[model samples]
Target: MGTIWTPKLNSYSGAKYLRLAQAAADAINQKELLANTKLPPQRRLADALGVTVGTVTRAYAVLEQRGYVYAKVGAGTFVRAEESEFKNKQINFATCQPPLTNQISVLSDAMSQLAKSPQRLTQLMAYHGEPLKEHQLIFSQWLHKRGITQQPEQIVFTHGAQQGIFAVLNGLMQAGDTLLCEGNCYPGIHTAAVQLGINIEPITLSDEGLDLSELEQKIIAHQPKVLYITPNNQNPTCIQYNLSQRQAILALTKKYNLVILEDDVNYCLSSEWHSPIWSIEQGSEQSEDPGHVIYLSSLSKVFCGGLRQGFLLVPNLYALKIKQAIHSQCWMISPLNTELACRVIQNPEFMGQREQVIAQRQQLCIEMGQRLGLKQRWRGLNGWLQLALPLKAHHVVTALAQKNILVRNGDDFNNHQNFIRLSIGDAADDKIFVQQLAIIEACIKSLSQTAYSVV
Candidate 1:
């Protein structure tokens, strides 16, 4: 309908198909060809460029595979829509969230029901000094089902998991006290530590779990007040601690009389749903005084992240301190949001749908990784890609960004630069998902061949 599109492929050096594809990619990237613009018919373009129709077809296929354009059967190919300059369109491997399912409809229904109930709305408006008993009971039952048994009294509501992390650190540790954690741990731990003026000491992590010997050595040297861990699907690595590893870590907690801040936020996505480290610590016969582990988890990972609903199970000894810290921070977590989360959790069909969505996404990503020949490990929604020498995470990330794809570098999670953390959270559909991975593969191969370096 617009001007008949013609590409200048002389400056690009590659196979004829690749050169044509590269020209299209460059035009899209440079904004010469805006999103949703239709290309000329294959026969017309082939004649204009003095190339065969088959060449144009292959070139279009390449463009589609790389996510630059998409073809509609009997309708010709058109540029894929670009949502934002920063986010691009379909590929965003940066955030870790539950895959899209019926959550939005569920939330909408819940909101409508709430709007119809004036009394319930009024209740949510008032400030309750403590988390509601009914909500606590619901959460307590939820925890019990997951193998972490606790009284409803011990559970405290938090605005989100990050808040729970901060509350535990601030409630238990002083400004100068040291905290020991995985060398490459959740970035939130570092952020919270900086705010509270707490010192963090890194412990070496092995494939099994934390290097036990290194953990004890750091414990003795630093006399840390707390140990933070993600027992299931450790962030950026997806390494699940085996039973023996859990027992060993629990033993260290008892020996040093150190508190364990157990972060099992990714429990919803874990296929095994293993008993949390907190449960093991509590059930141990050797435990003379059993309140050593502080468990933190959230609905954000399982349901909708915007809900900002999280709950913590604290020991009696530290409950008041953590409660006071929470009060000081935000007064109280929004009761309306909490109510919405409770409704979502109560839905009989929600959990099954959530699981199905997550499984499909996880399988797709695993298969893609296998096909790409990339060394990878996946647990839940996150995948860890290990890059061999002559390939670096930052360079790959930068190259992908140029193509309008976003991903996280390993250094963002830890000091390591050889891995990339891919969160399959924002992908729109299976087609876009495969295309994004193909683009990632192409970027990695191109970088490796050129030995790209960033100075």
Candidate 2:
């Protein structure tokens, strides 16, 4: 199994894993690896390639997650049945998701710590108000940790950032009222707007962020009721907006009588961050309307998505309305996730682990993408390269699914199938994950047509 290659780092390059994974996938796609084809033992591949068993394990995990490959506990990993999608269509690259952190210890610790006080859990088992004081503190601390002190009272709780979004769009604008979003935008918000019968207007975007001149023109002409932005960590494209551009955006928010719905859902995973929209010191509140801006963020990006916890910061003026809308449905967020979140926030070790986990996943994501010769049509978390898909994001996503890997394509965030995303930190061990990446490369090679290309 001494599959030695040239250069030391070459063994670990993101391209290496990409190529290897693609090779494995191609073997299956070409039917060279038959239905239920059991993958070679991890040690065998590791020894064969003169690589660590961990690497092999990662590659296998990648394959398994993509649905192209699978493994039973004591049994060996194998390819799915030929009738399965992995055997059907090619792979899609348009999905965007961060790696899952398998922190059994963390979960166990949280459970144990919370178990000591079952009373707290029991107390919160019932419904709480829309603005849960507990969650607000957690959210405020989260923002403050990032150097933002925009007040907890200004924050309202929501099911997820998605719900916060619904409130922002719902509370600020009326049906038939126009709004502006990134030319390339978060599709979730786009869908919500369409569902509510609100008009969505797109503003052209640059790598730095939205084009200020164009944004200004749109604001001045249409005088949109609201401006939706993902400033801290822009999504789908995953670009970080620059300081100048962000400041300019704040200026426009004031000038045009515009309501700013800063949809900052991705702030948690952002490798790089911008000052929050609220922190921008436009003018004194007594002198002007700082109430024009609204901020939304979530715990889902940092913790489990099932946490079902998100927050909104509005000018005290709109807090009541937003809370009222939240009240009508789901009444208030489930107190269970809230108290658990509070417990998580109180745990000092949690923050340290979060940093470590994000960095590790970021590194893995970079290496995986690089080994495959994946190029960013744009950038990503922590200054990493984000590749633009060469096919319709949905097609690439579905294709990847056929391989057994679950991913979020651009269409999840945008109606357009143009962009696709891949994350290194998602799900995989070293070697097996590399193997899975190799499958993606194969899919890219064999799969064609809907090329959205790059910026």
Candidate 3:
């Protein structure tokens, strides 16, 4: 080692090992500890920090696991050189999906089980007007677990959440009709509106959630036929509406005679399940008409994205129209895919494994953000980082792209903000995630400095 170094851990609040690791990451980020500098030995570091030797050992191991350093057999651990070129390979933090887990093996096992039953496989391969009643029942039970109490008859299967969104827009609204949504909303809504020739009016969102007064004002001004929202964890922004907000929205739908298209696709990745707006609307006993909310969810976030399995729970009045739209588009979703989804969800260990993977990825992202001093907001696997003034979102995005890393610019979702959306779902491993984030941190710092210089 060039010189003995002591890391300050007082500002960090975590387990001793994690705090030490974060301190080291801070040093690396600040350039106080350069690349290829050998780290202090475990005993010396422990004594300097006044902690147990095992804590130092664990902290060093964490550094290695995060791709910050490497350990030689006889030599002490040394900081790894910063990676510059990715050879055109991109580290993606754009598309939102659950982190990689045992989903592939789960699918493989389900496939093996299906292969052994020729009659069932043959049935699944055939065409049908709707999903098998058994499959619908399974999904109904799945929804029940999530606190949604819709019946099996209400379920309409579609290719994925994107298709479900399109089908709803096509079935309910005419070419000239208007739809209301959050000012900063999911990009899919914009695409669907443009394709269907439907006009969209945006309602401003406040710090808490949607600004209720603005929503009502827009509803009155536009006479919109439907309102699209993501209640559990809103896309791009990752803002989850509170119970009071949900109730207020439900009340507005009833007041304006407006239909709500509630997308809860990210609910599966949530650590805590909240009652959906659909459930609250349906469960109210005082209302004679309880069919104001159309619920949409998908198995892609919970299981495998390639399965492309999603479903919508429409009210009795609109079920036929929505099903017709689905039928007119693709006749029916592939029964084989639905069957595979059913099997995956039914696996005894599926839920536990899914929760574990989500928690681990979330924790990793949180730690990375802390070490880099990046302020972020998170929901499930998605995160939003607002760039400071003079440092633009697009510039950071371009810089990251030069290093073969991909992330979504906030403008993709809303033009009024300067931020970037990050989804850790596609990171190959924790080490890769940490390495990419480190690069992202460096890029942002360099751009920030350049921006301040020009000003």
> What residue runs in model 3 are displaced by over 4 Å at the alpha carbon?
1-88, 267-269, 370-375, 451-455
Between the candidate structures 2 and 3, which one is better when assessed by lDDT?
A: 3
* Tens-digit lDDT string for candidate 2 (1-455): 22222223343324343445556766677777777767788777666678777556655665665567878888888878846654444322333333443333345456777788878767777666755676677768877887776777887778888988887777667889887998767778878898778988898878789988888888877879888988877776766778888778877777777778887776344446666777775234543547778877776656556666777778887887787777766677777766666766666545333445456645655665566566553333222233354544556567678677756655555436355665544443344455666776666555553344221
Model 3 vs. true fold: TM: 0.79
Q: Candidate 1's residue-wise lDDT over 316-379, tens digit each?
A: 8899999989989998887877888777777664554457556777787787777667789888
Model 1's number of clashes is 0
Candidate 1 lDDT at 449 equals 68
Candidate 3 has which clashing residue pairs, if any? none
Q: Assess candidate 3 and give its lDDT.
A: 0.81
Q: What's the lDDT for residue 300 in model 2?
A: 64
- Estimate, for each residue in 1-455, the C-alpha lDDT of model 3 and write its tens digit: 53489978889865687678878877877888888899998988888899999788767776775567888988889887787333245888888877654555467668889999999988887788877999999999987886788899888888999999999999999998999998778888899999999999988777567999889988888898899988888887888888999999989888889899999887435555577899998889977767899999998777667889999989998988888888889888888888988888888646535565567777777776676566788878788888777888888888788888899999898754788988877764455667777887778777887735231
TM-score against truth, every candidate: 0.79, 0.70, 0.79
Give candidate 1's TM-score: 0.79
Candidate 2: worst-modelled 10 consecutive residues by lDDT: 1-10
Q: What is the C-alpha lDDT of each candidate?
A: 0.81, 0.65, 0.81
